[model samples]
Target: MGRRYDRLIGSLVGTCAAFAASPAAAATAGAPHLDGAEMGLIWVVPFVAILLSIALFPLFAPEFWHHHFGKVAAACAAAFLVPFLVVHGVSLTIYEVVHVSLLEYLPFIILLLALFTVAGGIRLRGSIIGTPAVNTGFLLFGTLLASWTGTTGAAMLLIRPVIRANEWRRYKVHTIVFFIFLVANIGGSLTPLGDPPLFLGFLKGVSFFWPTQHMFLPMVVAATVLLAVYFAIDSTLFRREAPRPSDEASEETFGIDGKINILLLAGIVGAVLLSGIWKPGIAFDIYHVQLELQGLVRDVLLLLITFLSWKLTSRENREANGFSWFPIIEVGKLFAGIFLTIIPAIAILKAGTGGALGSVVSLVTNDAGEPVDTMYFWLTGLLSSFLDNAPTYLVFFNTAGGDPAALMGPFASTLLAISAGAVFMGANTYIGNAPNFMVKAIAEERGIAMPSFFGYMLWSVGILIPIFVLITFLFFH
Candidate 1:
């Protein structure tokens, strides 16, 4: 009992120290900023409430989290603002560095929602893609495909089928856990499209193909280890199933409506690419015209594809899969909160990387001839689990910019380290990654209660962390 108390105190002290030493803990060099206590009140108060809403309030306010995620997210925003005001005392100076209008991260959040909604709508009936035989194969495909479709896209495509194939198993959390470990995190380490950090590198003059090269080996190693572990765990759980009735067997069916929905999806991608390529050719430089066009095209494509998928796919498939926008809506609502609440935190990070905070070595070379960054990749990845990986990636990218080694060969190794850290570690907690909470909410909507935030961490510590440590020592180090 005394040891436990001591451990708790040590944890609190460590947290306080981390907060005090955080690069974003202070204001820009020239400006006056809030003291540690004031910053603590703003960030910590709302953070504690979020933890309460997630872990404790569910006991009393059964519907509270689902019904009021927007409120909670907004409360976080208010927390950030109130302290900003207290520090500045009604001055407009806060506006110069922290712009509330910089809430441009919203559309990307929406894009994730729409993208997942479409993925959730797709299900296969006795399809090869959804079969247990193809489990390892599809996972690899999804992992490789992530660079093009995005990590969330690959996860959405693969998760349902993984669940379907393992439906008969009683101990199925193992499957979901492994799925989160691989499909959601490790699979997306190869390219900018696969994960957000690589995307930031692309925007900053790193070639599109750079991350893919370096990430290949690490990704291969991680995937191999995870697949082997999954197979062993799954083998232990796989049991003989009682035969289903003939009528139940005959009832199952699946197919896409036509090729149109697929075509529509293709068109959206093409339009986005064209918008990006043609931006420089246009007379007026409308900011993010590519993004605007891409969004417009994407929504139109999704609507058309959704209709086609509904009309073309078998009615039985729809019946078996009953419709619910709740999953997507829940993601929408929850992400709204995450987007708003974390904006200031991200802004602070960006500000610090832009010279508000003092400079520190972002990267270092280890004994194994591998280059590693302290602030650049590891920290970016650590935060990416809880925050948006995109912004997290940007923080590191911005920090590493202008450093010579950042420009050269085998940069993908560093990129892979960053990507693995961000994508995989997100499974450490329910809120670690956007998809973790969204997936949990979706599963619960389907009547499967995922582990709590800390409960999930047990898996990370016992199983995943050891794997990560191996990765760090063997591959990344």
Candidate 2:
């Protein structure tokens, strides 16, 4: 764990790096700056409780959770807000709320909504045989498609097609499991729109293509290996399974419905890219939070694009695709709590050794005080595997140094570690990423006896972990 330390310190010297920032210099730089150093660990309890509730409630109380999850989220959010308002005053509370909501949560959910809406409308209408090669092709194509369509969108779009192809086979659990690993999680690494955590990075000032540039190699490496492995396993399973009966074979030609949504998806991409590249320089203040014209335009355009896609597509297309609003609604409600509760966690991590999460700093740093890339990878990843990855990513991003310029420069590797960890390790569990559970639920609905929570981990633990180790050696190490 001992590093030369100079590299880390050098990284810190750049543009207010997060963890490396001097206690005086960093201190969570922002308006009405929250002094994380002054806040006790108790302040973090709500964040922890909310994440735990997300992880636990569905397992223990599916009925109550299904009906009342939104209320639970609001209660957890109030757990922090009520206390903060009382202690910090209405003005500061309002600023924090407005800042986070306007800058982070709103853009995030909007982007997800646009992608989900657009991709949901486009339905694959034809049938294809699920040979080993065809199955591998589905996975690889979804992996490629995920960066443009959000993981949720990509997974939702292709999963049914993949399942339909494989339904004739008796043994295809491995195919679905690998589908979760690649299409739902790892595939989203290449672009901000691909994953929530990366989008948070983009919102924080990481360029739209920063991930594409820096993350491409690692993504390609992991994807190549996983795809190769999937091909081998799938081929073996295909051999073992009995041949499809003549009646079960696909007689339908492959086609797609709602093809116009493809253009709309492009529109969504253009809107997001415009927000990043076009700085109109005009801005407005909303309760101490600065809102830019470009961002405003981007959001409005996204909403318009969502409207156009929904209006243009037939209800029949979405119904055939088995599209439902529940997944996105669940994400919106749950992440509302996540984004709110994570405020202090980000602040504390930004405060470094001076904050409640000081030990976190120690764990990811060497004795010489350099950031350890490997530890960052594992910790961020393992945490993301269990807790929600987006917040797990934000915590580590601030911990490294919240400054985008510095992180993109000297601490680039650290940011890469955090990014890869959050996106990749999300495949480790059903709850790790939003799409994981959705994909699992969909598979079960299709009559696949998907692994139980722990049962699924057997696939992840046996396959994904070793791949992660190779990734560490290839990049993070």
- TM agreement with the true structure for every prediction: 0.66, 0.93
In model 2, the runs with Cα more than 4 Å from the true position are 1-30
List candidate 1 stretches off by more than 4 Å: 1-62, 82-103, 127-134, 141-149, 191-210, 239-254, 257-259, 279-377, 385-391, 398-416, 437-455
Report the C-alpha lDDT of model 1 over 32-86, residue by residue, as the tens digit. Answer: 3433222322453454454344433333554555466557657765765676567
Candidate 2 versus the native: TM-score? 0.93
The most accurate candidate by TM-score is 2
User: What is the lDDT of every predicted structure here?
Assistant: 0.47, 0.79
lDDT of 2 by residue, 1-477 (tens): 011110010000001112222211122335576788888888889888888877777777777777787898899899999999999988778877777677777777788778878988998867788998999999999999988997878888898999999889998888999998999889998888888888878888889999999889989988999999999988887888886888876667888899999999999989999999998777776765667888889999999999999999999999887766666666677777777777777777777898889999999988987889999999999998887778788788888877788889998999999999988998898878777777777788789999999999998999889999999999988
Local distance difference test, candidate 2: 0.79
